[model samples]
Target: MSLFDTYIAVDWSGGNDRGAKPKRDAIWACAAGEEPVYLRNRQVAEDWLAARLEAEAGRRVCVGFDFPFGYPAGFAEHLTGREDALALWDWFEARIVDAPDVNNRFDIAGEINARVSGVGPFWFNGLKREVNHLPRKGLDRTNADFPEKRLVEMRAKGSFTCWQMAGAGSVGSQVMMGLPVLARLRRKYGAKVWPFEALDSAVAFVEIWPSLLAPSFPGGMIKDAAQVRAVARAMAVMDGQGSLELALAKGEGSGAEGWILGVGAEDLLEAAMKPIDMPRPPKLRDDCFALPAGVDWTPVDEALARLDAALRCVVGVEQVSHTQVVGRVVAEPVTARRSNPPAPNSAVDGYGFAHDATGEGDQVLPLLAGRAAAGGAYGGTVPHGSAIRVLTGAVLPDGVDTVVLEEDCSVTDTHVAFRGPVRPRANTRKAGEDVVAGSDVFAKGHMLRAQDAGLLAALGVDALPVFKRLRVGVLSTGDELVDPSQNAPPDRTYDANRPMLLQLAAAWNFEAVDLGHVRDDRAALKARLDEAVGQCDVILTSGGASAGDEDHVSALLREQGNLQAWRIALKPGRPLALALWQGVPVFGLPGNPVAAFVCALIFARPACLKLAGAAFAEPQGFMVPAAFEKRKKPGRREYLRARMGSDGVEVFASEGSGRISGLSWSDGMVELPDGAMDIARGDLVRYLPYGSFGL
Candidate 1:
């Protein structure tokens, strides 16, 4: 069954009321498989829609309106002191004062402009008489505090700016006037608005642009009427095909600025009207950390490839406040809510004037009485053949397209002189230049840094959805091991691997849980494993992982859990046991401290990050010249603890896996390939720095 049983489209009007007769610019609405119905004014249109919706009770319906349901990001908060589109709607609904033929839309526009600036971002007064701050022409207004177009407008080609009020292609007035009606209908019917709320309601409203589809009806019908009918039928057809739900899915920049229905699904709409077959998206499976069959002795590259294929983001998402998001992975794309700098402003301290006002050569122009500073804009427009003093970061006054730096100009009490041939629109930052509204700032799986938090703050984002941190439990198994705080006999050594592994997990931004140490007993290790599964998402065991008699970790996994014993061809680390205990992934590492650390860096770190909802990233390595020479065999790969010396990269004095002091002595690792290699002094070799592993 289709999600929606009915679809309706409305072509709204923002101009003064037309008489009680069928006309072109009056409000028009059409239901699927029905003729267009014309309403004389806003009041009649609202009444007709309410009646139609009331008659369609118990049926799922979607209403599409041509006017924008929202303004650009930051506009709602700027006007209403809250970052909510519905609040802005309420704000307008309380003060709009709409009647059949006479409304205070122009006065309201002027009032809104007065709050933002004495001059406007809102313009085009269609009335004959003047309004307080509203201008008649777009060029007469200074829009230095907000972007002229919304993010959706930039993406939807040929879309009109929501700033224009009553001139040709003006959508701004419609938004200001239409939102009040939408608010009333939503409150009365409990209908949800698309892109703002989840589409779970029986009656849902969507923002539509009728121009997206060409209308085909008998000749002589009003263009607006034809459009509403065409759009309404198209929506119903697409809904039946099941492609409409995909089109309504929330995307980048749709959070605050809203979205046009079928913006990216133009092809689907066209094909749906023709009744053609549509492709459905494939279903995704969460088979994270699942091992493939038939894996035995593995190469370094092959092991890494297998791990990459088996891993996916296994953590759930949460909306975290911007202040606490650092080091958290983004669950979705974080887009810019508002542009940085917001509007065009002077880049340097200068004399601002219109660039085309004069011809080439040295020129002089009268100075305006006041200056445009960073906090305040010049109240009046900058006339031709005149200039105004403007400081760095100041919003350029209307008609001022260019600025000549103070250092390049000669100033007097009433005038300023500068060399001619200045470039048009020079020394000025364009609106949305640094960061554009609706543009993606960070993609999914991105880890937030301190600077990222600052950028989000500047964009007015209070909170964002981020994946929860992965929980990693560290366990060590060895009969000869004891805690560092306890006295140990000569046969026993202090437990170094557990503490190191715990710290490493913490450094990698995972929630580190100390599962404590387990001795070489099958029943005791099993109890610890069961407990870890309840407390952690993943477990790490550092000893008794090989196929020896005392290898309880591998033996227990083989008997009670799913186990994959991988004998990797590598120095220091060879026997790697991977398993799933109670559906939680467990990594089994070697007993030697240095070998365990190497294996953790090479394999476990990236896999853990992937499970934590971070993108799988390979450890970055660069080539550095070797300071020492050595001959290697063709069978096993080797990594020597190393650091950059005065001449080149210097390897540790020994290649023994038990040399725990070598790890602390070195800053990175020097990797040797599997094939036989004869390395001499000054021969370049790949160097993997500790920092590259996120240490």
Candidate 2:
């Protein structure tokens, strides 16, 4: 069966009435397999739509509207005191005054602009008289409070901004006037709006772009009429082919700004009316971290891009107590079970009374017998002209809308007296003020912190789904190295890389597994890797990662696994061998202690976090004036060990990769761009603290 029995498309408009004749720049609607019809105005359009929906009861139907369903992210919360699009619809429906030939949309727009900023986010009034706050041209408005375009508009190329009101391509006025009608229909018919709500309802509304598909128009047909008809027919055809469900897939921010159906599925929509050969989906690869071919001496940014595109979370999820979830990556979004504070409560130790009891001058009120304290609230309603003593966190008794702080009152055994002019609902916290019940508190892939634990407890979330810790196996290679605990020969050195890497992995909240040290023999390295694949989700090896003859780490990977020895254009570290052995990812790091540390921080850390089921996030860096002067050549990025000093950021004296002391000498790193430049003492440079990299 098809997803929908009927499909409807509407070309919406916001301007004043244009007589009874069918024309452009007016509302028009078309149902699949039916003729396009002209709508005189919004009132008639709403009536006709309601009648159609009533007649189509019990049959699955989908309606597409041309105007935007919502504004940018913060606009709803700023104007309506709620972050929901439907709430904004109700807000507009309550305030907007619409009639057959005239409306107060421009005035309402001006009022909204006055609330946000006097200049305008909503502009271009078409009225003959100048409208205050609403500018006549886009150039006169300063839209600094919010974004000019919604997130969906940015992705859909050639789409007009939803901020302009009277311009040729403006959709702002249409949204202001049209959302109210849709809101009424949705409430009356129980129809679900796509993305904002689930699309399981018999009647569903979706955002649509008529220009998304190019269809042949019948001769002498108006462009708006032809567009509506074409879009409706295309949607119906796609539904019959069982491909319309794919077009309704939800994306990021779709719930907030709404997505245009078929915007991302242009090819499928174009081929809906024709028979075509569909290519078979490619086979899934077992090796996910395999680098692309011909990638040689890649730039640092390019290498990061490749890694971000290739990696996916490889761990399984389990339910853990909120108490133990710190440092764990969330596998599912956690919604609040109850609101913070749970009920209206006093914000200070004070006397609570109804605001209307006292006015004009100093008034005296008699005290109630009982007092409301934390965990012990007064049972009865607070009578007018009477005050009840209440402490912070104590639930406000009925009939009490205001609280006068005890410090501001002269209290005796029988009565409490305070000054006049107490604000309504003063010194009292409203229920759901901090967090509302059923609202999303944390999204999937969020790494929990200690503060998150307190929030979870407050929200009554006892347990949550979290990904299992990634098991990272650390293995150090080289015949000249021995464990620090062991007696080493004069020619041998201690295996510092293994201990350092293992500790770093643990510090990053991963399960660090000691794979021990392996010599430069190919057979020994192969045995160690074969064992590591089963015990670890990822294997990290230092030394023997280069293309040298004794580079058994690279040799074994090239011979047995999918290996790509990426020579990155970065100072201190260059050779980075990424491979997959037996479906487990492996990171081959440098032999030098300094290079291994830098490469691990800059490259391996983010990749590992993603693989451990955490969301992809770049380490934040801040710009600071440089304390030292240096002239750097182009082609490779340089990172100098740095620390914040009195002048600005001070770098270590040397840039040698073998100087392991430099790593410990500084608290952070200063990064230089790839282009050649002369950095003076006063010049600004990007600095990244160790904490920013999850140190």
Quick one: best TM-score, which candidate?
2
Q: Which ranges of candidate 2 are over 4 A from the true structure?
A: 1-293
- Model 1 misses residue 342 by how many Å? 1.4
Tens-digit lDDT track of model 2 for 1-695: 35676688999989777679999989999887567999989998999999999988987789999999889878998977888888999999999999887799999999888987558888898999988898888888876988888888887888888888877788988999999999999999999998799878899999988766545343457989988877777777676455687777734456577788877777767765332232322222445555567656799998888888888888776545454577899888999878997999999999999998889678789998889988897889888889999999999999888999999999999999888888889999999999998999999999999999779868766546678788999999989999888999899988889999999999999999999988888888888889997788888999988878888888889888878788899998899988888878889999899899999999889988988889766789999999999999999998899999999999999998888888888989999989999999989999999999999
Over the stretch 61-128, how does candidate 1's per-residue lDDT look in tens digits? 89999999888888889988987888888999999988886889999988888888547888888888
Clashes of 2: 0
Name the TM-score of candidate 2. Answer: 0.59
Please give each candidate's TM-score. 0.59, 0.59
Cα RMSD, each candidate: 20.9, 25.6
